[model samples]
Target: MQPPSKPAPPEQQATEAGSVTTPVRGALASLSLAMLLPALGTSIANVGLPDMAKALHAPFQDVQWIVLAYLLAITALIVSVGRLGDMLGRRRLLLAGIALFAVASALCALAPTLWLLVAARALQGLAASVMMALTMAFVGSTVPKARTGSAMGLLGTMSAVGTTLGPALGGLLIAHFGWPAIFLVNVPLAAVALLLAWRYLPADRGGAHAKRPVFDHRGTVLLALTLGAYALAMTLGRGHFGARNVALLLAACVGAILFVRVELKAPGPLIRLAMLRAPVLGAGLATSMLVSTVMMSTLVVGPFYLARGLGLGTAVTGMVLAAGPLVAAFCGVPSGWLVDRYGAQRMGGAGLCGAAAACLALSLLPASLGIPGYVAPIMLLTASYALFQAANNTAVMGDIVPDQRGVISGMLNLSRNLGLVTGASVMGAVFAAGTSDITGAQPAAMIRGMHASFAVASALILAALAIFVLGRALSKP
Candidate 1:
């Protein structure tokens, strides 16, 4: 026989292994739209709050619920819906979610009263929870294991793009069409996502003889209640903590204890405690939360420093704020490539090191250097964040058993959400304390607040780095 033909090139081999299959590309498109719509929903409405309040004849506080209702529903119900998807079927549930989201978006656009709009937003949030939680879970089945990092990176990029596009797009839509246009835009996007998902996502694999998993109703209710209470405690009253906040926080703690007690005894628990005991999964979630907290500091603190301290105009401040997500969107895919080449653990550590360095630079750099100094560090921080997110998600999802993927993905999203909520309150408070009165603070005071806030952020990054290192060491055989 003739000598064996030379092996295929890496790209061809990857294609043969199904990474670039038509069905895989279709599935990825479906997942990308799913990720994008939720992120767009989250940020797009903020720019239209004034218009909404004027149209609905409501105060700013009442109009704010149009946003808060959506956020609260997603934060509370994400894990419960994910578990339900595992018991039912992810594909079927995702299709239902997309359909529901489309309907809710239409309702939001047509609502005549502020309360009605808020109710529609709540419903939309429920749908978004399914899309967000299940999209990452579906990644395991859609793409080859070798390309997990790439897929994760792509999803991250889409998320960043949605966030970056929302304010600008919403402004244009509202200026020309009205506030409702922002919600109405989601309808067509959801239809496209639904069609792709229906056509290409792998069908749920189980026969009539298959023993379906039981749903843990008690655990689900308790978890939802606990999370709702905690979210309310963190978000209500803006940044000022009060007696009501304390009471709500205490109730959440009690609810959490009850939830754990119920889960431990349930025959079919919503989440198995043993899974969290795994060092890699636990560390990944913890670091995700920490990194998210640090990242949110940039949002909460950056605007004040840029506008008040640096004396930038409104348009300039907005442009400067957009740069972080822009850099993150561009870096996400390359970061995934690095993860695939260098391994998740190594890439994760390197990302954390870079993040810590960037945070330190932000803390120490003088305000005299102005926009360039601030922008440079923020870009570095965001790029590093993209690398860490890709590596962490790939590592966590790489080996999960198929049945548990939905809940695990939900937990990952939940951790990041909670961190964002916490950072908004905690970091805002830290900056407020440093400045004494932020509204009338001098430039020097604003600089002080910025320094203090970033110093704390740098500490948070170091803590995440420690957790990552410790987790890897313990995960070793």
Candidate 2:
């Protein structure tokens, strides 16, 4: 007779069963905070811009750099920082990033000059890029593979919470403690995150004897410059593309060509071109960008539609606009749970179908049905987006090897950010083209613009769905 084996250790059992143990919980809390801080940093300052401009004696155009600097820094450097984490150590880099973020937040809070504050914000963005990139990278190492979607969902929830909380929290803080309070809030949160990460997160593997790949400094610089140019081209003119925008865009195109050439010839490339040729990764990135573009259209066009088309007051419009993100925030965890239950590829397809249907409904139904109609479709769109995000993130990150997680995670984030930038430009243009003098347009013109915008959005969602299906087909042997 064979003897019965002893039960696995509590930690091992919990992992095997895909349950969150104490250690896993702590790690998740740290990662969630990491994700949240960057998101908060992105949105919180928007509410304080007026105060900041007044205090610093800067014009609105110059003050806008306070936001732009941070965004540009993140967009330009995210992939490089992710690669750095992969080369050095994610835990080490992430801890350093958290510490740096706290210091930069203090610098922003204390800066006396506008440009100084902008510089500090840029520094803060650099740290945020590391945090954002590495937090997702750390997921595969921290949780059981079966629970990757759940972890991703939790991180998504934190991101939505931070984004949603930022405007409201910043308003209250500014009213009570001034604009600096917005930046100062991050200090304590970062400190707590630092402690949690130091104590609970897993240490990096390998030792001094393990061989490490060479850092691609040339590729990094070229890619950063390329991305910076592209971001500037997309963002500089605020909705109206001008001569400088065209010049920057052209420069970006040239820089991209040079970057690809440099990367291909390098002995140890920053990004393996072959990896992009793989149907799954390439299609994942493309679909992510497409989906993000559609999502951003709602933000770009929703306010105008509510205020002009429906004749809602500013307060009511704001509240109605808030509903989309709130739905997304609440749906995040459940969406992840569904991804885990049904599998990422399947859930991803389901989410895309739902999104397409919602977009079509928004395009056709909202004018006749009014606020309830608009709100319902927006809610469905956001919920579908949350599901798609969770599923897509899981599908992409779940199969990545540990060595490449950081860079791959960075690529995923980069794709989404690029989509946002493009959406703000292209979708805004489409909306504007659909209406004459958008600010003073009549209800009919506003409705027409809204319909045109959502119709385009629906098409984008359908394209993403096609890409998803094609990718799955091609990935099969």
For all predicted structures, in order, the TM-scores are 0.96, 0.96
Please give the clash total of every predicted structure, in order. Answer: 0, 0
Candidate 1 positional error at 461, Å: 0.8
TM-score of 2: 0.96
Q: Which residue pairs collide in model 1, if any? A: none
Q: Please report the TM-score between candidate 1 and the true structure.
A: 0.96
- Candidate 2 local lDDT, residue 138: 88
Worst 10 residues of 1 by lDDT: 9-18
lDDT tens digits by residue: candidate 2, 1-477: 989999864435656878787888899999999999999999999999999999999999999999999999999999999999999999999999999999999999999999999999999999999999999998888787788899899999999999899999999999999999999999999999999999878888768546788899999999999999999998887678999999999999999999999999998788988899778889899999999999989889998898889989999998999998899889989998999999999999999999999999988864779899999988989999999999999999988888899999999999999999989988898899899778788999989998899999999999999999999999889
Candidate 2 global CA lDDT score = 0.92
- Model 2 misses residue 17 by how many Å? 4.8
Taken over the whole model, the C-alpha lDDT of each candidate is 0.92, 0.92
What is candidate 2's CA lDDT for residue 448? 90
